[model samples]
Target: MYQQILAPLFGSLGWSAVAAALPLLVLFALLGLVRMTAWKASLIALAVALAIAMFVYPMPVDQALLSATLGAAFGFFPILWIVINAIWIYQMTVTTGHFDVLQRSFSRISGDRRIQAMIIAFCFGALLEALAGFGTPVAITTVMLLALGISPMTSAVVALVANTAPVAYGALASPLVTLASVTELPLADLGAMTGRQTPLLALFVPMVLVGIIDGVRGVRETLPATLTCGITFAVAQFAASNYVSVPLTDIIAALLAAGATVLLMRVWTPRGAEPPTSEPAGSRAEVLRAYAPYLIIIAVFVVAQLGPIADLLDAVTLKFNWPGLDIRDAGGEALSLTEFKFNWLSGAGSLLLIAGLLTIPVIGISARAALGRYAATYRQLAWAIVTVMTVLAIAYVMNTSGQTATLGTWMAATGGLFAFLSPILGWLGVAVTGSDTSSNSLFGALQVTAAEQAGIDPMLAAAANGSGGVLGKMISPQNLAIAAGAVGMAGREGDLFRRVLPFSLGFLLLMCALIALQATPVLSWMTVM
Candidate 1:
């Protein structure tokens, strides 16, 4: 078996870290500075990563190529699987003329665009995030905001920013579960620690969303409603994750936050509220028809994920060693990632596909028409498919070739100062992988190992990895492609990237400060320990 090495460049951790970072630097420069289209930039970056894997890290050429193919397969099966079906459901609603009816129904709740954004993008988006993480929330919510007359770019930005708070508990706390498994830490402690941290971010996310939608004036005008939603969400998230259940945290927080906002709107109205001009709101029956698809999705997921059903699904899941590629760590242990788990029937994409089929009759569409829409959806997402697959390929090549470990190892050399940089490592992970779950998997054990060496709390460090990774979601190439595609701004991903990058960095800094403070006696009590 080929073995991984931490410092392949002159046995110097510092130089190896810089060499390992070139692929990512090339990626960001192309996307951010050069403003290149996402697919082209990703392809270029993938080439750079392959070069580094073969020459810099000196990995076998065949193994490096095989790793990329595996990642590409994964990116399609699970990641793109969710996005394509979710968007197809939205397309079905549009085809049935129910989407416009849904828009009018939302306006019937409140005329203020800002309040509607608070409800749809922030509150409702969290519900989607909880149910189906990955790019599902971003793709679905951006289109929803656009339906309500928000500009495409603004809708995408709002959706991306709003997706953050619920992510630690997203897909029923998958990220926390992954972190727990990787670090061998208590799942409850990881959940509890993350619950404490991300809820603080939750407290301010609505306001940030308002500011994005309507500038500082939006925050000022809707202060009461924003405060109400943020407070309720933060408190409920903290309570559910710590006291009740980890997986239920986002569901509890989202429903309460939405309910609280609806209640606030009853007693208070914001200035400059303009009702959306559309056809009259649909009848109760039509409104129910309009909402049936999303309700069906939630039902399908809840049923599939519960007790015996979830167990049966897992039993059918095929886990096998990846073909023709085997590499061990520096310690000579086989890599777990070398094995691929194919959850064909139980994957969220398959569930979404099932939901799409169920939605056919509910929305008065036939199988023939639905199949046509499905084909069209595939054509619509063609480039997004390429962008996502290539980005995941780049991630796998770097990971399998030990570029990621080298960087993490170099960063961990900072001793006690590693606590402050812990979140940055997590941020970088998600920025590359476009997944908090994947990020925690990549860096969770590294964070805990570094924390132990530095005499800091491992739980705090691991939780920080997940918390900071959430912010990086806004900048991930896969997310940018999804958001851009959702709002019909495909080639303008760079614009969306530029719009959201500042907030991503600013929020990451806040998370870093919070994590650092928690490592000290000042805020050490906040950790679950």
Candidate 2:
């Protein structure tokens, strides 16, 4: 097996690290500076990564090609799988004329755009993140915002921003699980530290969403509702993640936040709220039918999560070592050899596909019509498919060739200031890989090692990796692809990325401050022992 060499070119770690980052820099420059489309940028970036892997890192050609193929396969099976079906279900509602009723129902709850954003994008979106993450929340909620008459670009941006807070606990605290596994830290302590850190973001994200939706005036007018939602969610998240079950943390938090928002709406209305646009309030049964798709999704996901069902589903999962990709890291540790387990039955994508199919009868559409809609969804998401696959391939190539490790090793040289930079490692990982779980897996041990060397609490640094990684989700290419597809801006992934970059960076800075404080005596008491 070929082993990675971090400082491959000049034997100088700094220069080698800079060379390793060229592919990402190319990606960002093309997307942000040249304003190229996401698909083109991602494809070019993938080519750059392959060249660097071969010439600089000098990875074997067969192994590099296999890595790219595996990444592309994963992107299609699980990532695009979820995006396509989620949008398919929404399209079913539109085709059946039920989306109009759904829109009217939300309007009746709160006519103000600010309140609506808080309720749907922040609150309901968090619920989706808790249950069916991996682009589900962004895909579903962006479309919901569009149905509310929000502009496409604004809807995409708002959904991306609102997705941040719950992501640490998302998919049943998967990111935390990955962190614990990587750092060999106590799971509970890591959860508690993460709980303490991310709730700060939770308390402020609703305000950010409202500001994005309607600016400072929007935040000012809807201050009470925003505060209630944020505070309630933050408190529940902290309590559940620390004191209660980490796996159930986001579920409890999302439900409580949604309940609080609805309860507050009964008594208060934002000042200067415009009159809601009038639409036919369909009968109660029709409204319920309008919601049937999501209900089916929830029920399906819950049942799939049951122990017996999950075990049975696992029986059919395809697992194997990826062919021609066995390799080792610079430290002579063997990299993960297991290929992507094709979790066909239990995956969120399969569940979403099932949800879409079941919605056909509920929405009174024939199987042929549903199939046609599904096909149309594929057509709509063509560019998104390309973009996501290319981005994932780039991530895989960089990871396997040790390009990511080269960068991480360079960052670890920060010494005492590494406390402040810990979260940035996680942020960069997630920004490249598009999953907080992946981020924690990539950087969690690095955080621990860096902390030990820097004379800080290893657990605190590792937990910070997870807490801060959530902020990167909004700006991740996979997520931006999902948002762009959901909002019918399939080729404009860069636009969504540019819009959410500020929020992502701002949240990263806040996380750095919080972590820096925890490392010092100022907030050291907050770190879980």
Candidate 3:
């Protein structure tokens, strides 16, 4: 068994941390500055990480390869699985001409681009994030915004930005659940703390989304609606996560915000409303058909996640150690991450496939046509598949080789300053892995350990990890690939990366400050017990 050494570079944690960071620095520099294609950048970064694992961290070469292979397998099965099926379901809607009807229905709500953005990109996008995390919200919403005649870049940015607030509670609070398991903390406490933190993020996202769609003018004209949507979402999110169910937090907030936006649109319309972007509205029956797929998705997920059903679905999942791989950390404890859980039947992607099949009858599409669309989605997402798999491989190499641990350990060595840097760990994790669940898995225990070392509240730091992770979702290479693919702008991921990078950093800074203050008397009351 190969053992990890945290400080493998001349026995210095600081120098080791810098070495550990080279892969990430190379990735962002290539994607954001050099404008290299995503797949190329990912492959190069993967090479860099593997090299570091073998030479710098002095990991066994075979072990690093196995780790990468495991990650690539995971990336394809679950991560790419979700994206492929979601886009296929969408393509089916387009095939049956329901997508146009859906567009008309939104325009009928209010033709103003800003209002449409608030409703579609922020509110509905949150709903998508609630039920289906990962790249689903960004992929689905970017296309919907494109249908609304929004520019490709703006639609991608809005989808990515709006994806933030609901994320920590996303997929029925999966990220927090993971965090709880890793940190050995109470799930409810982590959920409540995250609820408190992200609602503040929820409060301003609609305004940010509107501004992205139409600049200051959009924010000025749609202040009433954005405020209504944002405030309702923030309040409901706070209540549901704190008092209500954590799993249902995003769902509750998203529905309430959507209802509020719809109610406001009935009485108040934004200034400078444009003409309807689609053909005349379809009959009520057609409208219902247009919406049936998404409804079906929610229903399927809810049923699948129920106690008995969820257990049964999970019963079929396969869990086993990766072949020919065994490694312990510096503490001589085996890394449980080396074991893989193949939740094939119960995975979100499988449920989405079920939802798609159920949708075929409701939307009146033939099974054959649906299959054709599925194959087409595969063809469309080919590069996205490569980019995602390679990126996840990079994540795995970094994780298993102790490259990520070195970085975290080095940062934790900062003592009291670690509170301010806590959220950045999560941000960096998610930026690399593209999932808050994965980020928390990577950094949750690290955060708790560091917080205890620094005399900070472990719960606050743990929650901050997830809260900061949401912002990085916007700039993740996998999400960028998904957004670009959805808007038919594939290979322009570099452009999308450049567009969302500033927003990611800006929000991360704010989250850093919030977490830092929460560790002190200033905002300590805002934290949960």
Point to the candidate with the largest lDDT: 1
The count of residue-pair clashes in candidate 2 stands at 0
Worst 10 residues of 3 by lDDT: 272-281
Q: Give the lDDT of residue 372 in candidate 1.
A: 86
lDDT per model vs. reference:
0.90, 0.87, 0.90
Pairs of residues at least 3 apart in sequence or in different chains that clash in candidate 3: none
Worst 10 residues of 2 by lDDT: 273-282
The segments of candidate 1 whose C-alpha lies over 4 angstroms from its true place after superposition are 275-280
Task: Please give the distance, in angstroms, between residue 87's alpha carbon in candidate 3 and its true position after superposition.
Answer: 0.3
TM-score of 1: 0.98
Model 2: runs farther than 4 Å from truth?
274-280
TM-score of each: 0.98, 0.97, 0.98
lDDT of 2 by residue, 485-521 (tens): 8778977877777888988999999999999999999
Per-candidate count of clashing residue pairs (backbone under 3 Å): 0, 0, 0
Residues 243-277 of candidate 1: C-alpha lDDT, one tens digit per residue: 99999899999999999998877767887776443
